[model samples]
Target chain A: MFYFILDILGTIAFAISGVMVAMDKKLDVFGVFIVAFVTAVGGGTLRDVLIGQTPLFWLKDLTYIVTIIGAVIVAVVFRSRMSYFKRSLLLFDTLGIGLYTLVGVEKGLAVGLSPIMCVALGTITACFGGVTRDILCNEIPVIFRREIYATACILGGFGFFILRQLPLEETYSYATAILIIIVIRLLAVKFKLALPNIYKST
Target chain B: MFYFILDILGTIAFAISGVMVAMDKKLDVFGVFIVAFVTAVGGGTLRDVLIGQTPLFWLKDLTYIVTIIGAVIVAVVFRSRMSYFKRSLLLFDTLGIGLYTLVGVEKGLAVGLSPIMCVALGTITACFGGVTRDILCNEIPVIFRREIYATACILGGFGFFILRQLPLEETYSYATAILIIIVIRLLAVKFKLALPNIYKST
Candidate 1:
């Protein structure tokens, strides 16, 4: 039940963020909805597809689809107040990546992937929605270029594994791992940390 | 046997195109290989996933992976004379889309999708590897912005259905569909056919 609520909130956050990005592109109404839909579901869809999970998560459960639509509509309707919710939105987005990371890691474990691959899958689930959004909007993905987003997920994944080796319960390890990701991301943004410039000075 | 040959040829062409694009960006060796691999197999991978085909086409068959590696190596080795092979490359790429479009359509049909959705799937297969390539390379996909690529696949899909209704053999319809896509694409390029400018003057 807790995970389910977080998933819905994450879906809503992703959908709203997607709307914000699409609006920046001045896309048509249909274009905006499509972008929002893809943004909210693209990561999970890709993860499911990669693992051979057929019918897809969203297709099986209408919750994600309905949540995204509602979120998009609300965001679009309250466009003028977006800036006021920016911080809140950021919080929700951070929570999203945190929960999504665990969801992916668990899925990878179910498939019996190596620990490293599981971490990679977790990061993909957390970050690749934004990757898809950037691709659709014709820009380098923020994570690829500068953000500490995937790095936070990776570190959290390591934490998850480390905690699993301890005497802690699985729930404790899971929640602690999520908290680690959230803290890392929040602190990274708060301190304005970024990846080193990969391209040499022109 | 014929389909297998066409599939290999299509894989080679797509891989070569990926290498060419990655080369233009001056990416590193690993990056170039990744782009090429994705370009060669990404479409079919996506098609299989959507239809619930597990293990992916490339995973099930080592042929595509081997073929893409070979194609990329050759393209990179002969990079200095790339312009000289531009026309031959173009022809090969056209053949690729023609074949890939049918491949996707057949997959969709196998899963009992309607003709229209199957056409959409076919176009996705024919064109989205380039989309993935462009996204990775940090640019708008050429097809989404400027090419007649997906349009050719779509028109050919219509031709495929029409040919099927003529009491022709399945082989004849299939061959005719591929031919339609190739001919339309060649003509479009030869005549500089393009979707009308969607973006107005800034």
Candidate 2:
């Protein structure tokens, strides 16, 4: 139940972010909705697909669809006021990524993937939506370029595996994983930490 | 057996295209490989994921990987000669898309998707690799902006459905569908046909 609520919140947060990007790009209404939908569901969809989960998580449940629509509506309606709520939005986005990382890791474990693959899955699930959004918006993916976002997810994924090996209950391990992601992301942003650029100019 | 060969050829073609794009972007060797891999496999990966296939096609088979690597190696070695081979490359790419479109549609049908959904799947399979490659190269997807590429696939998908409805052998239908895609794409390129922009500036 808790995870379900978190998933919905994450969807809304991601959708809102997508809306902001689409607005920035001056996309038409259809384009805005497409971007918002892709941003909200793209990562999870990819994760589910990799795990051989058919029909996708969102397609099976209409609630996610409704939630994204609600988010887009709110974004369009409160466009002018969004800047004032930036901090809160960031918090929501952070929470979303943390929750998604854990969910993705759990799904990977359920599918009996290797530990490394599970961690990769978790990071992909937590970051690929933003990647898709940025790509659609015609920009380099922020996670790949500017921020320590995916790194945080990878750390959290490792934490999840490590915690699972301990004597603690499964729920505790999951909580620890989520907490690790949230803390790392928060610290990275607060400190303005970034990964080294791999691109070399000729 | 025929499809398998076609799939390998298509992978080589797409990977070559990816290498070309990466070279144009002045990406390093690792970057070039990454782009090549994504361009060769991205569309089929998306299709597989949507249909709930696990571990991905390339993950199961090393042949695809080797093919991509070979393509990248050849591209790097013959970088200066690529412009002269543009016409042949176009033909190969067109063949790749046609074959991929049929494969995607067949997979979707086998998984019991609606015909329209299968057609959509076919178009995605035929085009998304290039979309992913372009995005990774930090460019807007040519298909979405200025090409009749995806349109040819859609038309071919429709042709597949129509041909299947006939009393001819299944192989004939499949061959006809692929031919339709190739012919349409070749014509579109030759005539410089493009979709009108849907993005309207306010």
Candidate 3:
């Protein structure tokens, strides 16, 4: 139940972020809704599909969709004041990603995938929503070019496996993994760290 | 066996198209291969994932991967003379899309999805590979802004359903649908038809 609530919060944060970006791009109403919907659920949808989960996460439970729609509406209504809540949004997003990575790792383990593929799946679950949003908006995915966004998910995934090998309880290890992701992302942003760029400035 | 062969031919054509595009973008060899792999298998992957099919089409069968790698190598070897086979490539891509659409529709029908959703699955299977490729390369999807690419698939999808109502053999309807997509695409290209522009010029 606690995890479900957190997942809803994360979905709300993702949808709001999508709304903000779509509005910035001046998309039509349908476009804005589509963007928000995808941002909120795209990662989970991909994960579910990859694992052969039927009806999909969103399709199986309408709560995620409802939350996204509500979030989009609220964000759009409070667009001018959104800046004041930027920190809250960012924190939610970070928490959301952390939880998402854990969820993905768990699902991969359930499906008997290799550890490496599980990590990859975890990373995909936490980050690919934004990737799809960027693609739809006709921009390069920000994660591919900069920051520790995906790296945080990957590290969190590896940490989960490592923690599992320890004598600690499963719940404790899962909590630790989420914490690892949240802290890494927060610290990375605070320190302005980024992945190394391959292309030199022309 | 014939359908499987057609699928491979489609995969090879898609991979070659991806290789050409990645090469044009000056991506590294790894990047080129990734593009080729995704282009050849991405659509089917999405479809399979959505329907809760396990192992994925590529993962279940090595033939698809081997064919894509082979196609990439052949295209690269003949890179300079690729212009000579442009028409042939286009035909193969058209045929591939047609086959892909059919495959998607069949999968959806097998799973008992609604007709509209089945058509959606078909279109997604036929086109999203190119969409993924363009996004990775940092360009707007050409199908979204122009061309009858998706339209052809959609029309073909509806055609398939409509034809099912007729008192004819199943094979006849399937063949007609594929031919419809191919013919529509060819005619649309030859006449330079496109979806109307959405944005107003400043």
Model 2 spans with C-alpha error above 4 angstroms: A1-37, A43-52, A57-131, A139-202, B200-202
lDDT of 2 by residue, A1-202 (tens): 9888888888989998998887777665545765788898889888876676886766445687779888988888788788887888888888899999888888888888999999999888989999989888898777877898999899999999999999999999998899999999999999999888876784
Compare candidates 1 and 2 on DockQ and give the better one. Answer: 2
Comparing candidate 1 with candidate 3, which one achieves the higher TM-score? Answer: 3
- Pairs of colliding residues, candidate 3: none
lDDT of 2 at A44: 88
Worst 10 residues of 2 chain A by lDDT: A25-34
Give the per-residue lDDT digits (tens) of candidate 2, residues B84-176.
988988988999999999998998888777676687689879898998998888876666556778888888999989988989999999999
Pairs in steric clash, model 2: none
By DockQ: ranked, best first: 2, 3, 1
lDDT of 1 by residue, A1-202 (tens): 9988988888888898888877776665544655687788888878887887875666445577668879988888788778899998899999999999999999999999998989988988988898888779876777898888999999999899999999989999999999999999999999999988766776
Interface C-alpha RMSD after superposing true interface residues, each candidate, one decimal: 6.0, 4.8, 6.1
lDDT over C-alpha atoms for residue B94 of model 3: 95
TM-score of chain B of each: 0.96, 0.97, 0.97
Query: Where does the lowest 10-residue lDDT sum fall in candidate 2 chain B?
Result: B193-202
**C-alpha RMSD values across all candidates:** 6.9, 7.0, 7.0
